[model samples]
Target: MSSDFEGYEQDFAVLTAEITNKIARVPRLPPDEKKQMVANVEKQLEEAKELLEQMDLEVREIPPQSRGMYSNRMRSYKQEMGKLETDFKRSRIAYSDEVRNELLGDDGNSSENQLIKLREERAHLLDNTERLERSSRRLEAGYQIAVETEQIGQEMLENLSHDREKIQRARERLRETDANLGKSSRVLTGMLRR
Candidate 1:
């Protein structure tokens, strides 16, 4: 049972690690690092599925008495991993939408038109402090959204590091379990011989 859990942990670790590394390499990622993160996640997901297949084989090779426990663990792990990936993907989409809206401007106004209008308005308002203040507010609002988008991207990048740490810890745990299992198997064999 523990061994099966370890196998699932190992696969999760590997997939998460791949995604983390890919995210780390992205430069100045745009709005939630959505595009790059999505690409990396998709690739990792494929790899994870392959690893899961191998794990299934390993579980089948175990003694029948132990198979049920391991199989249950594997199923639970698959569900958890799937949920996490789906949530992460959803986050990316939400972030992308926020960024796109900010960059392209609201539905009623295109970015280009907004910019042109701002410039014209600013020019006309130059002689009037009140109008100038209004134009300035509009421009500032756009700038603020852009800044927020950039910040969100940075947060996503930081999340990759956290994800990598989690995976590394999981990998370490799996390796420890593998070593212990090997030792126990040897001990059992020796006792049987005696």
Candidate 2:
């Protein structure tokens, strides 16, 4: 890490830290408050993007390697969405079948009745599958959020360990200084040797 790079990094971090913290606060907001918060974030992101583009065009050039970001945990959500959809479909079918039998009687009646009932069941299943798709999408989005949060927490704990080590060293130095304080103070108290 070059000094100049570290200096720029710190400067940029200072500039954006408040905004980053504000973004981090989204999860703490209730669903009722999210619309405004989301709008604010969307505006911020757009403005930031345009400013960055102008910077790249006129002032500082951003390298290709650092240009964009994509979340890796998104793939996990894709996988989970599929599983959630299947689980939802299975549960809905089981529950609906139980309810249908209780209300419409068991399936020992005429063939025409059974056919109509089967068609109705099929339509209901189709509706449920569509609903489940929307639900799974929303659920996976939250799952991805949660996974990212856990990752950030792990990073925070690692930084905390580093801070702990520094604190321990400072404490040790303080003890050593205290032990030698009396000898050092005597020379000062004597005004060079009284």
Candidate 3:
């Protein structure tokens, strides 16, 4: 195996172990910390995915005779990644359930609990609506910027076209001047000969 391949393998090992440790720690963390840890783990998982792709590409570049062992290792790594992702998801679900239970309490079916749930839902909807409105405004701003950029580009192209036409006219004048110079030289030669 190439040194680069070995390096990537080592990096992947360390990353996966780190992710696994983070996932395990999520259960013990406070709600805010758990959220942050989960986000970090998710990002690490994406990095792991990229490393796996790099390893797979590296394996493909090796000789066919040597490929079988690397291929097996790749399969094992993929299975490990799958298990890690599943564990991460399970941890997230467990955390969510814990939060939900804490919020709903033992009398989850009571009228009071139902009213609380309704208010929470309403607030969540309001937050979503505000986020959507903000997103729409941002999209409008982006569209306006794009339109202005296109107009600027069009004006630049027009300026270039005008410059090209001016150059062409200058070249035409130069040719006419050369022709007149040649005619003047011939007339002078004829007069000298006479």
The numbered model that scores best in TM-score is 3
Question: By descending lDDT, how would the candidates be arranged?
Answer: 3, 1, 2
What TM-score do all the candidates reach, one by one? 0.42, 0.39, 0.53
The order by descending TM-score is 3, 1, 2
Candidates' RMSD to native? 23.2, 16.6, 15.3
C-alpha lDDT values of all predictions: 0.61, 0.51, 0.76
- Error at 132, model 2, angstroms: 2.1
lDDT of 2 by residue, 64-135 (tens): 433221223224333433443344345345444545564675656575487567656755754565466557
Which pairs clash in model 2? Answer: none
lDDT, residue 59, model 2: 22
Clashes per model (N, Cα, C within 3 A): 0, 0, 0
**Span of ten consecutive residues with least summed lDDT in model 3:** 125-134
Better of 1 and 3 by lDDT: 3
